[model samples]
Target: MSKTDVSKKALLSVNDLCMYFDSAGRRIKAAEHVSFEINEGEVFGLVGESGSGKSSIGKCIIGLNRATSGSISFHGTELTGIKSRREYTEKMRDIQMIFQDPMSSLNPKKQVGQIIRDALKIQHIGKDAKERDKMAADAFRRVGIPVEYADRYPRSFSGGQRQRIGIARALAGKPKLVIADECIAALDASVQAQIVNMINEIKKETGTAFLFISHDLSMVRFLSDRIGVLHLGYLLETGTAEEIFREPMHPYTRKLLGAIPRCQCRILLRAANHSVRLSATTLR
Candidate 1:
């Protein structure tokens, strides 16, 4: 199904997700009472400034860091309540993460092909060694990376290429939900656009829901079906992309838009309008 026709089925839900840290005997509230739900086959963007707790929420969902309180559920199963090892393993396969820095996110020692194959093995996706190899090659091709370069290491590829490899690794697991935590922050402008377009294509083709965390509003506007504005550990506002851009309810949201360059702001507005038109035409 297309994004415009997305069903109301909730694929992931977070309620009162509060992640706190203690640094130097001081309590730091990274995220407080933040709540949102992602529907099946939807792209949900979480946009905020630096230190606004965007990555903290994504990390909490993926089990990198446990929340100090609150609950996170996937397909009605609370992440913290899984009683069986088998069930926990299933959950891990269902949700995958693409880290911010592709340079550091990948294994420096392994070949790019091996990296993807290793994930498939860990997730128990392919039946045999030959099958895993084929899947790994397919993953590389899917991300626009040449299969011939599979033997090369991550350090050998450019930043954009490395990010594509990271994406390939994430997709090799065939996850239902992927958390992209600032995945484009480290890339150049042209490469960032390419990755964004690639991600948009992946979402459309695979129907994989995404929690795209970023500080770039324009990129989020281009990618997100629904957006939640986060600031200083609180989710300030949420709505469809059209609503957030056309008529921002929160003052901070307006401030963010105002911060964009005038020419870029016009481009963003036009893009949003264009998206709305396309959606309407598709519905008709």
Candidate 2:
């Protein structure tokens, strides 16, 4: 597809999407007037602190949580109030989710092979058990998981391995868009880089769009083509990663950047604080 074709073809379109909950006598707005478009083959980063409604937006897009108002259209179809199982399944196939924790996402009782095959079985993609098994093994290999490990339980593997299994499962159906909610947060720093690189590679190879939600600004900058900042359930800013990073316009965006640790500056800040405290004690 040409650049214009890819830009115009949004895998997911969300407009004015709002989600609220009744907590005691007060109302909590988890997502307020959130609007964005995720184009084909683009990785969009949703950066926010906890309670900023980043994950809530992902849940609403995937149909795990209901929206109170606004619209979510996947491709050209509206997804609100989709109750039919067939319709839901079709929508889900187009948009898959990779959650933060891989261990919890997989079934403890089911073998790794069975878990990967479940989506294909449910979608009735393969004609027979042999075809399904072959497809599952291929998916596992694509995500860097050894085919032999498919028979083992999730507990048998390390965090990175389990995450690869999760990615394999998510791609088994060849979804157009994947919502990765803090998907790399649980892994070690080194493993996090590997997983992020793997995700970028897959996106480039398959032309899959990704909505990567995380609080890690640096990582998001590395992975995202575009970035959206959220604060207190509202979207503060949206722009290309370079624009947002080099010339942040929103106050919240500035604060979020300030919170990130700079090696030399952070040490200097700590030393200055310590000196100020000592001075105060002497004066008192």
Candidate 3:
């Protein structure tokens, strides 16, 4: 199904998700009462300034850090305080994460093919060794990586290529939801656009839901079906990408838009218009 025709079936849901940390005997609130829902086969963009806890929320979803208090569910299974390993693993198999730093996210010692294939092996995607190899090569090919490069090390690849590998690793699981945390931030603008386009194509082919976390509003606008604006660890506003870009309700959102004075109006207009053909569903 296309994004515009996405069903209202909630693939992931978060309510009152609070992630706090104690630093030097002081409570640091990273995310408080942040809530949003990602519909089936839709892109739910989360945007914020640096330290706005955009990645923190993504981490919460992937279980890198536990929620201090809140609810996170995947396909109706509650993830908060989850005690069953098998349950979490099963749900996680339907979920995968692509970290921002491709170089760091991958294992330095493992070959690129091994890295991608490991995801399938862990999930047992293939019934036999030959099938698994074919699946791994297919993933590499889909991500624009040559199957021959599978045995190469990540350190030998360029930044953009490494990012592609990271994406391939994430998709190897054939997950229902993929949390991409600033997956293109480190690359140049041109490469960034390429990755975004690649992601869009993959989404269309796979019908996967994306919780796309990024600091760049333009990028978010280009990919998101719905958007939630975060500030100082609090979700200030949420609306259709067009609504938020064309007319920002919160002062923070406006401030963020206005920060790019040179291309302020241009960015907002393009982003707003980009959403014209996108789905209308937004988090309430």
Writing each residue's lDDT as its tens digit, candidate 2 over 1-284 gives 23453546777889999999788999988999999988889999999877778999999999889999999998889998898989888667778889898769888888999997887889777788899899899889888888988889988988898888888888887889999999998999999999999999999999999999998988999999889999878999988888899989986687676665556977658645654553454345
What stretches of model 2 exceed 4 Å from their correct place?
1-7, 265-284
Clash totals for all candidate models: 0, 0, 1
Residue 268 shift from truth in candidate 3, angstroms: 14
Compose the digit string of candidate 3's lDDT tens values, residues 37-72.
888888999998777788888999999888999999
Q: How close is candidate 3 to the true structure, as a TM-score?
A: 0.88
Q: Which residues of candidate 1, in runs, are more than 4 Å off?
A: 1-6, 81-87, 264-284
Worst 10 residues of 1 by lDDT: 275-284
For residue 93, what is the lDDT in candidate 2?
75
Q: Which of 1 and 3 is the better model by lDDT?
A: 1
Prediction 3 global C-alpha lDDT:
0.85
Candidate 1 on 167-268: residue-level lDDT in tens?
999988778999999999999999999999999999999999999999888899999999999988999988888889999998778766655544677776
- Give model 1's clash tally: 0
Report lDDT (Cα) of residue 100, candidate 2. Answer: 95
